[model samples]
Target: MVTDRFNSLGRPARLVALCLLVVAVAFLVLGRWDLALAIGAGALLGWVLLKPVRITWAIFAVAFMVPVTIDLGYPTNPSYTLLLVLFVLAGWGRLHRAERDGWPPRRIGAALLLPFCAVLAGVLHWHGVKPVVVGVAPLLCIGVLGWHLIEEARRDPKLILRIAEVFTWVSVAVAALAKYQTLTGTWPLFDQFAYDWTYTSVFDPTRAAGFFGHPIVYGSFAMAMALVSLTIRGRYWYVPFTANLIGLVLSGTRSAWVGTALALGIWLLLNVRKIAWRGVATGVIITVVAFAAVAVNPSTFRIGTSEPPPTWVSPTEPGTKPSPSPSTSSVDSVGVAGARMSDPVGSASASARFERIAVAWDGITRDWSTVIFGNGPESSVRYLEDVGIGDGQAQVFDNTYLTIWHNFGLVGLLSLLGLLLALFWRSRSLAGRLIIVGFAAQIFFFDVWLWLSAVGVLLLAVALGAAEDRPWPTLPFLNGLRKRRPRAPETSDASTPGFAAAA
Candidate 1:
C-alpha cells in the first residue's frame, strides 16, 4: 500500500518540482536573485522528484530557452550561462555514450577547431589567458551540444520533424512578443533601451527587438527560425509562419530582410520540382503587383522618426572633433522599410559601414604577422578604440567577417570560411542548405556572435542541417527534396563508425 501510494504521487511530485524550478529560474532571469534563491530552496525539497536530464534533451532545452533568456548587463545574466553549464555537465555524464556515438564528424569538428586554435595561438602570443578562455569556452559548449543534436537526430530520423516543430512553436512565441512590442512600443520583460547602439536609426520606436537586445540580431534570428519553421507541415502552420514573417518585417533589419529573401529564394530553387509552379507564379505576380502599388505611393505607408547621426567623441582628447555624423535622411524620408530596399550607396549607414571596413582592413594589414596570425582574441575592439571609431565605453562591429578577421587573423577567417563552404557542400537536405545560406547572408551585416540567442539558435540550425535529412510522409511533395545524396567514400576526418554502419 505504501509503495502504490508513493508511485502514484511520483508524477505529480515531479510536475510540481519542475514548475518550481522553472519559476525559480524565471525569477533569477528577472534579477530577483533573492526570490529565486527562496523558490529554488523550495524546489530542493522535491529534489528526488527531479530526474537527470538526458544529454539530447538538455541540448534541446538550451536551444529552446536561449531565445527568451537575457545575456547582457554589467554582471551578465547567469541564466543562459547556467544552461550551458548544465548542458556541459550532462554531456560529461554521457561520456560513455559519446565514445559509441563518436565525436563530431571529424572533418567539421576540425574545421570548427582550427579557428579556436588560431585564437588560442594568438592569445598565447599576447600572453593573455583571459582572451583564450573567453574564445574557447563558447566554442567548446556550442560544439559539444551541436554534435549531440546531430547524433540524436541521426539515431531517430523522425527527430528532425520534432526539432522543426519545436522551432515553429518557438518562432510563434518570439513573433507574438514582437507583435506585442509593435502594438505597444514597449519591450517585454525589460525596460526599453534608451538607444539602439548597433543601428543608425537609434531609439526608433517602431523597430521591435522581441527578447534579444539588438533588433538586427533578433530579426536575423527570427528569419532563420521562420525559415526553419517552414519545414513544419502541421495544419494551421501558416498562422505562426505569418506571425514570424511579420515579426521579421517589424524588426526593421534590412540585412535580415535581404538574408530572408536570399534564403527563401534558395529554398524555392532547390525544391523547384516539388513546388507548385502555378501557385508560386501567382504569388510572385501578386507580390510584384503589391510592391509596385506601394512603390508608387511610399510616402503614405511611411511612419516613424529618425534621430541624428551617432557621434563617437574620443575620451583621450575630450575636445577632439567627432567623426562626421552619418545622415539619417533616408530613414527620415521613407521610413525603415523603404530605406531597407533603398540603394546601399544612398544610405549613410551603408557608407559608414564601408568606411569602417576600410579602416579595419588598414589596421589589420598594418603588420603582416598581425594580419596573418592576429593580435589576440577581441583585439578588434581595442584596435577600433585606438583608431577612434568608438569611445571605449562600447565596441561595435557591424560585420561578423570583419570581427572574425580582426580577432583571429587571416588564418582564422579562412578557416571559418572553409567551414561554411564545407557545411554548405555537405548539407544533405534542401532546408538545411537554406538555413546555412540565410545565416551566411546575415553575418555580412552584423556581428552575430555577440548574442547567445543568435549564436545558440544558429548552432542548432547548423546541427539540424548537418544531421541526416529525414523525409516526412506528411509532406509527400517535399519528399523528393529530402532525398539524401549518396555518401562519398570514407575520408579521414569525415567518417564516423556508427554513421557508416547506419548508412
Candidate 2:
C-alpha cells in the first residue's frame, strides 16, 4: 500500500527535486556554496522523483539559455557540465529497473566503436591528457546523454515523440523571444548587445538570434526542430513549425537557408510513400506563412534576402580578379566590434574558404605521419598560428570533412564515415536521416560538429537512438540488491553410485 501511494506521487516529487538540484548546482557553481547546500538537500530528500525525461528538459533549457561557457577558469561550459552530471545521475536512478529492448547487434556496435577508437588514438598519440579532456569533454558529455536518452526510449517507444514535443515547445519559446528581440533591437539576456552589434541588416532591426550565441546556430537549430515538429503527432504541429521557419528566415543565414531547403526537399522525396496529405498541406502552409512574414516585415527581416548573387567578373591581371568594392566588403557599424568588414582578398568569404582548403591540405602533407594519424587539434592551431595568412592566422579548414581528416587522418575519417552510414541504417525515420543530411551539408560551410553546437547534440542523440540501446534496471542503493538462496545438499548414495557409474 505504501509503495502504491508513493508511486502515485513519485513523478511530481521528482520533478520538484530535479528543479531544486539545478538551482542548487547553478548557485554552487557560481560560488554561492551556502545556498547550494540548502537546495541540494531538498533534491536529495526527494531523490525517487528524478526522471530522465525531466532532466533532459532541464538540459535543453540550460543549453538554450546559457550556451556560453560560464566565467570559470576551465574551458567547460556550465550547461554542458551540469547537464552531464545531472543527466547521468537522474538516468542512473531508473536504469536498473528497465527492461532490455532493441539493443544493437555486435556488428553495429563494432562499427560505432571505430570512430571513438580513432579519436581516442588521436588523443593519446597527439594531445596530452589535460588538453584532450578540455577539448573533447563537451562532445563526450553530450554523447553520454544521447545514450541515456536512447536507453529510456527503448523502454518506451513513445519517448521519441514526447522528446519531439519537448523540442517543439522549446522552439516555440525561442521563437517568441526572437520576435521580442526583433521589436526591441536589444536582446534581454545578452545585456546591452543591441541587434545592430551582433547581427547584420539593411534596416534598424536585423537578423534574430533567439537565445543562442550566434544567429547561425539559432536558425539552424530552429529549422532542425521544425523538421522534428513535422514528425511528431499533433494538429498544432504546424504552429511550431511555422514559428521556427519564421525564426530561421529572420536569422539571415544564407547557408542555413540552402541547407534547410535541401533537407526538406530530401525529406519530402523519401517520405512520399508514407506521408499524409494533411502533413503535406501543413508543410505548404507553413512555408507560405514564413515567406509571408518575411514579405510583411521587409524592414525588420530583410538582410541578404533582396540581394542578387554577385556576378563573376574577368580578372584584371594575369591571374588576379578585382577585389570587392567597400560597399560589398564593409557594413556601417556603431558598436563595440566596430564596423565589421569581410576581407576583400584572402579573408574574403569566398576566397577565404578556398584559402583554408589549401592551408589544410598543406598542413596534412607537411609530414607523412600527419597524413596517417592526422595532425592534432592543438598542433593544427599551432600550424595555423605559424602560417601567416592576412593580419591573423587561419584556424579552421572551412570544411567539416577536412577538419576531421586533418585531425584524425585517413583511418579516422573513414571510420567516421562508416559510423555515420551505420547511423542511417539504424534510423527508421526519413526525417531523422534528413537531419543528418542537412548537417552533413552545412559542415561544408562551417565546422559545427565540435563542442556544444546545436547539431552536435542533435546528431549524437538521433544516432544513439537509431542504434537501439538496451534498457537496464537501476536499483535502489540497498533494497534493490539481489539475494542468493542457499544450495541444497546432495545425497551420499547418489554421489557414490555416480562416482564409478555403477549400473
Candidate 2: segments with Cα more than 4 A from true spot: 1-49, 69-127, 192-205, 271-284, 298-347, 384-395, 449-453, 456-503
Q: Each model's C-alpha lDDT?
A: 0.59, 0.55
Name the lDDT value of residue 369 in candidate 2.
Answer: 72
Give per-residue CA lDDT, model 2, range 398-433, as digits (tens): 676776677767666676677566555465454566
Error of 2 at 160 (Å): 2.3
Candidate 1 residue-wise lDDT, 51-147, digit = tens: 3234444455544454433423313434336445544544563464566765555734653575475565565458476667666556556555555
Pairs that clash in candidate 2: 14-49, 95-472, 95-473, 95-474, 96-473, 96-474, 97-473, 97-474
Q: Which candidate is the best by TM-score?
A: 1
